[model samples]
Target: MLTLIELVGIFFFAVSGSLMAARRGFDMLGSAFLGGVTGLGGGVVRDLILNQSPATFAHPVYFLPPVLAALCVYAFTPAVQKLHRLVQIFDAAGLGLFCMTGTMKALENDVNPVTAVLLGVITGVGGGMLRDVISNVTPDLFNPRDVYALPAILGATATAFAWHFDVLNIAVGTGIAGLTFVLRLASIRFGWSVPLAAGHWHRQPNIPNHGDGPRRNF
Candidate 1:
């Protein structure tokens, strides 16, 4: 289930990246390159942290899907535009699924709870981060107003906790994945975010007199 979800996510992200590349008037090779990176970048990072070769490199079929997705997007731009909401839904689903999968994989490798959560967050956000870096934009996850990375953190943490408590058997893991999926989708629909102080600042205290020489104060 997790593998299938990741594949679905990869296809949509690849298509989205390819469309963006097309908008930039890139040639076929450029489009394929962008699509492939957007699709597989997260998995590659997860594998490297786990001290293993990337699954995409070992299984060449991993490359085919993204390339094909790019071609389809290039050939059917208008149709894709018409289904933009559907694409967003797929992307959200993929995000949740990948977070869960990364957490599970980390646990299987005997990673501690904190490391599992970190890996899960990395797996969830790494591809999009790479995509934004390639596109020369600041990542949306870093924006205080965006709801991207929070959902992944919430999902990953939940999975780690479940594993730690031995509450996530195969059936329970599926449920946890479902829970993460719902949380992410709700965040999308509701524009959820961590509360922040808007237009507020705290003044720093001055340091006491040190000596005859002038001193710097924090």
Candidate 2:
């Protein structure tokens, strides 16, 4: 079940990545690269933190699905564009599944609850972050106006808490995943955002390049 869910999530994320790449006028190779990174980057980070081989490297299918998804997206651009809403729906599903799966893997590795929850959020958002970075865009999660990380955090927390209560077995885990999906979708629909003060901003303590002038924007 876990493997199946992971594959489904990878496929959808790959499709979304492909779409984004196409929208940006990337070549086929660039689209494929984006798809692969969006599908596997998060899993790679999760595995590394857990001191395990990255799943995409360990499992051949894990690597192929994203490539295949990119090819399909390229071949069916019109169809994919027409089904943008469906793509978003699947993306939300992938986010929820990845969060739960990451949490479960952390638990299997005997990680503490806090670490597991954090890992779950990382696994859910890391791929998209990689995608954005590669595309030279600010990651959506870093944009306080975006609803990228909150759903994953909430879902991971619920999973960890439920496990502690011995309530989130397989069925309950699925429920939590579903709830996370719904919450993410609703956030998109409602434009939910983290609270931020209009005049309050935090500045970095250290500057990476002294030759560069002081940063003006917060």
Candidate 3:
């Protein structure tokens, strides 16, 4: 069940990644590259910080969903276009799932609760950060105009707290994930936003941060 949950998270992120790549007018190579980066980038960073081998290096299956998602988008542009509308949900799902999984893993590895929560947030959002950076655009993460990291941090905090208190399990994690997911989608539906500093605060109207994922354009 754990492995399946992780794979579901990977697949959701892959869909968002590939959909973003297609919308970017990228070719197959670009689609695949971005897809993979978005799919596993967070876990890669998490593993690195934990001083463990990247699961991507040992589990090639992790790469499959991104490539497959890219191919599907490339071959079925119109159909994929329809699917793109759900990209926000996909991103939210991935963010929530990874936050849960990352926190659990960190706790299992003996990381302290506070630091584990931080790692969980990083593991959940790092891929989207990499994706935007590679695309040569500022990510919503740094954009104070966005509200992504909040849900992730909340979920991670919940997960870490549960673990430290000996109550962390699939149920707790799932609830936290759901909390993150709902909050993110609500932010999108309700135009929830955080204020940025003056002069440095410019909203990137083109791409709203769908919670640690790419927008329709960048």
- Candidate that scores best on TM-score: 2
Predictions ranked by lDDT, top down? 2, 3, 1
Deviation in angstroms for 72 in model 2?
2.5
State how far residue 134 of model 3 sits from its true place (Å).
1.8
The runs of at least 3 residues in candidate 1 whose Cα sits more than 4 Å from the true structure, single-residue gaps closed, are 1-5, 23-25, 79-88, 165-182, 195-199, 203-218
For candidate 1, give the lDDT. Answer: 0.75
Clash pairs (backbone) in predicted model 1: none
As a whole number from 0 to 100, the lDDT of residue 54 in candidate 3 is: 90
lDDT of 1 by residue, 95-120 (tens): 67678888988898999889999998
Give stretches of model 3 more than 4 Å off: 75-85, 197-218
- lDDT per residue, candidate 2, 64-156, as tens digits? 878887889788786535554654565677788889888888987899999999999999888888877887877877888768899999999
Preferred candidate (TM-score higher): 1 or 3:
3
Better of 1 and 2 by lDDT: 2
Error of 1 at 103 (Å): 0.8
Ranking by TM-score: 2, 3, 1
